[model samples]
Target: MATTHADDPGRCPEPLSTPDDFMGGFCAFNFTSGPAAGSFCWDRQPDYSAYRESSFGHGILEVKNETYALWKWHRNQDLYQGAVGDEIYIVREPERCLLKSSIAAYF
Candidate 1:
């Protein structure tokens, strides 16, 4: 899950209580049953990694030399949405990818 820093503080999840801005609630859920002829919990956590915002410093995720997939969806013609938006082949050298302890040295 990817998260960003919040502008201001928020009422943290108090004990077992719900968070002031519960990100989980935004995700839709269902109740599937064999007797009913449907499925439940179709869209659950970790399935669609959520990018939530929290009251903390922000930092971007650094993905290097990785195989990633980008996808899109349509209400009607959803079949083709799974097609790759762009095929990316990343090649990052370890030496160039690493950051120096003395950042000013580069300058």
Candidate 2:
């Protein structure tokens, strides 16, 4: 459910230095079930160590339904090619997923 949108207004396509220039595109993540099910724009960097690695790629998590989701990683170098990392139909139980409750209650 994530996608890169059109370029930002008045911003040059230069390297990212500050947080303001870090996010070049927009990504949308949708939740298909549970009480907090909804769509949201993930315009921020994740705390995951894998994402912090020195790499030029993007990841997407799409919730197909209540228990099924898809994850994809696209490298910047190979835009014309297919996704470098791809997985589908991942089973996620909302009630049993501890991270879900913790993150939901964090705020």
Candidate 3:
């Protein structure tokens, strides 16, 4: 689950045992706003080689080479929204993604 940085300063999972190895788990993040506002968790059931975010309304995930896209469902408006190259970070070891004040232009 996602939480404030002051609540849980999570650590990245341990490295895979081998290059071809697979590890399964999850990581909580403290993102600023939006669907991932609080108590957010990312699935790492296969591997941490990629980043992903999903919710009832939308999903943003990495496809390859650190590229990501957003898919949203505007059910009431009967429209689907999508975009590529959304901002995200894949934190590992000695690094962290922290929350800050939201910027109006980002909307």
TM-score of each: 0.21, 0.35, 0.18
Residue 8 CA displacement from its true place in model 2, Å: 5.8
**How much does candidate 1 score in TM-score?**
0.21
- Cα error, residue 66 of model 3, in Å, equals 4.2
Candidate with maximal TM-score:
2
Ranked by TM-score, top first: 2, 1, 3
lDDT of 1 by residue, 30-102 (tens): 3454322243222223434454333222233335425433333223223453443333444543444336343
Better of 1 and 3 by lDDT: 3
Clashes per candidate, residues 3 or more apart or on different chains: 2, 0, 4
What are the runs in model 2 whose C-alpha is more than 4 Å off? 1-55, 94-107
Task: Give the candidate order by descending lDDT.
Answer: 2, 3, 1
| RMSD (Å) of each candidate, 1 decimal | 17.1, 13.4, 15.3
User: Poorest 10 consecutive residues of model 1 by lDDT?
Assistant: 4-13
Tens-digit lDDT string for candidate 3 (1-107): 34232222353332332232232343335556543355343322334333423332333544444333333332222234443323555434222223433432332
Model 3 lowest lDDT segment of ten: 14-23
- Residue 21 displacement in candidate 1 (angstroms): 44
